[model samples]
Target: MKFALQAKDILRNYANILYLLIGITTGCVIGFLFGNQVESIKFIGDIFLNLLFTAIIPLVFFTIASSIANLQSSERLGKLFAIVAAVFLTTVIISAAVMMLVMLAFPIAQDDTLRNMAAQAALDNPVSSNSNTSATGLAQVLTVNDFSELMARKNMLALILFSLLVGFATLRAGEKGKAFATFLNSANEVMKQLLAIIMKIAPLGLGAYFAYQVGVFGPQLIGVYAHPLALYYITCAAYFFIFFSLYAYFSAGKQGVTVFWKNNLTPSMTAIGTCSSIATIPANLLGAEKMMVPAYIRNIVIPLGAPIHKDGSSMSSIIKLAVLFAMFGKDFSAPEMLFAIFGITVLVSIVAGGIPNGGYIGEVFAITAFGFPMEQALPVAMVIGTLVDPIATLLNANGDLIASMMVTRIAEGKHWLNSRLPS
Candidate 1:
């Protein structure tokens, strides 16, 4: 019996290792072959993107609103929002700074095919062209007359603002909004059911999305784009160790971080296997409890933090947007990059504390936040969405543990900086 159990464990470990190899090799192949054939690869990616988000947004809306309602005081709600915004803003600025520094070390060349496509479109719609439009320019034209309006109208900033409004209002209504809130609350439950049905077919979507991406990108782009990919990987590894470990040690205590990491192996593994933070919440909650986090913090913070407190996701967002800007042969001024980071973090952080399985939709929202061309933004999503999910989830899970510690200290009115170690 013991031997059989050992063999099963070994097999499972090997299977996971094999899956990583397959996914990397597959993604490389597709990205290389289809690097220039943007439309076809994008179509497949779009299908998966749509299917992933069809039910995710509404579910997040209600769950977040419901979670806000659970707070004992409006003051606590204000505090929570403040903490979220601060953490998100800090991480975004760091990511954007890192991305800017990295770009200086690895200059990009514009893809001729993408440029040709833009030129042809400009000619076809000459009425759309203005004095600002140029035949040789690689960057997409952004007209001052409508750029900010388009960004707002598309709902990147609006979705976040509206969600916060709904959450705050839901808290304010003495009783009149109770029925309407009740309907949204119930709707949130039903949406989870729909998500469950869709998730069962997630493997199908994953396989097609990846296979189609690999078939298009071909195998050679990895070698062709090795420099940037290498830099991205280095950034990922550096954060995983340096920033996260330091934060964990200081915030959660060294012993707490070690215990949390050791016991929460299952959640990390599940995140990697599924590539969805929402799907891994059960393991995350269990792991936090095992690490001795208070029940209230575990139940409330872990679920809410999964979507919102994505240190790695925010990091990857800055990197992707920076890369897209560079790929079009445009340089973002430091101020522009700073604004992108600040704005993207706010937009992305709105649904952060929502229900599970909403990561993909958040990715879509991030792409829209910056108003990058869909072709460029979508491919980056394919790369980040497929590879970054697990790493981001681990960071997110860690952030929850870390944030809970800070929140608990705040709630207890304890000064964390000068407090003595617990006896």
Candidate 2:
């Protein structure tokens, strides 16, 4: 009887997600039949993306600033960031470890074609190194020269840092800043609702976009790249189903797993369809809320994690290393090599996740670290990154929602979910 109630509740409460699923599935079928001919319809998805992108600037600013400013106790703010950082770093390592094991067990791909390509690539491009004296490049990544630059989506790390500073300032104001805090909180609510409204068209927008993706990239999933693509998608799917369930169970026991999977579908689909972690923030926020995670935690984790907490990238970074190592005939089975790959993947997934051109940054770093030919290694890894993006984004985006559960259990006690449940 309880199971029946839960089933009915999911169907009733999550009906819109079902519609989205149906729409995307239908779109994929349509795309398969028409192939590249659907290019004309891309404008539909473009419009939705533009609206979302424009709205996101205000949404992120308001959510983070308000969450910080409106935090009732300053200590909670400290705990939140502390717990978040720990969770993010821990999960990144876990993800990398899981993928490394899989890669070691089953090498990505070893082919003469890849080797020949690598040789040609080495001849084509010269290797370059960083100038030791310069911290300028690092500074630019975390902040922008002009305040106006923060308004752009490309400068997300800068924007997040700026938002944190604003929130912290308002918080430190105490009672004297009550009015501004209220205003920030109010703005956050309004922006959240606006994002919700924008997402109402997710079915149409995401469906159309998914169609385009299928029509364009579907054919590339064959020949040389086919095996590597299969490995990634399959590994990601297994991790998504298995590890996420384990995390959810750890967070709140059996009930947490139930609540999590019920609410996870929308965020996962949104990530898959959009292939952008930033775009899936709202869905993740809503998903966390539905699971009864505290708003303060979700508000902070979802926005920040969307940019940085990349379980998916952690896995993919390892794959990139594996592919490069294979291409170069390196002893990937060596413990020393895996140790180096482990450290690099962790850095690439967590640190580069927030920076622009993170893919390029990660790929180039992997190439240089292994002394792989940059010319050949870079392009091959780039291709793999593109191929795995959708699934990777699925893991990266949804990981935040589940992380909120972990934080809640730790911060609010193990009985947290029980209180949120009906008596």
The candidate scoring highest on lDDT is: 2
Best by TM-score: 1
lDDT of each: 0.54, 0.74
- Clash count, candidate 2: 0
Cα displacement (angstroms), candidate 2, residue 44, comes to 31
Off by over 4 Å in 2: 1-77, 125-223, 355-358
lDDT of 1 at 229: 57
Clash tally, candidates in order: 18, 0
Tens digit per residue, CA lDDT, model 1, 365-405: 66555554443345445454445545655555656555555
- Looking at model 2, report the run of 10 residues with the lowest lDDT sum: 126-135
**lDDT accuracy of residue 115 in candidate 1:** 47
Query: What would the C-alpha RMSD of candidate 2 be, to one decimal place?
Result: 10.4
* Clashes by residue pair, model 2: none
Off by over 4 Å in 1: 1-100, 107-109, 113-156, 159-167, 189-229, 248-304, 327-334, 349-358, 403-423
Whole-model lDDT, model 1: 0.54
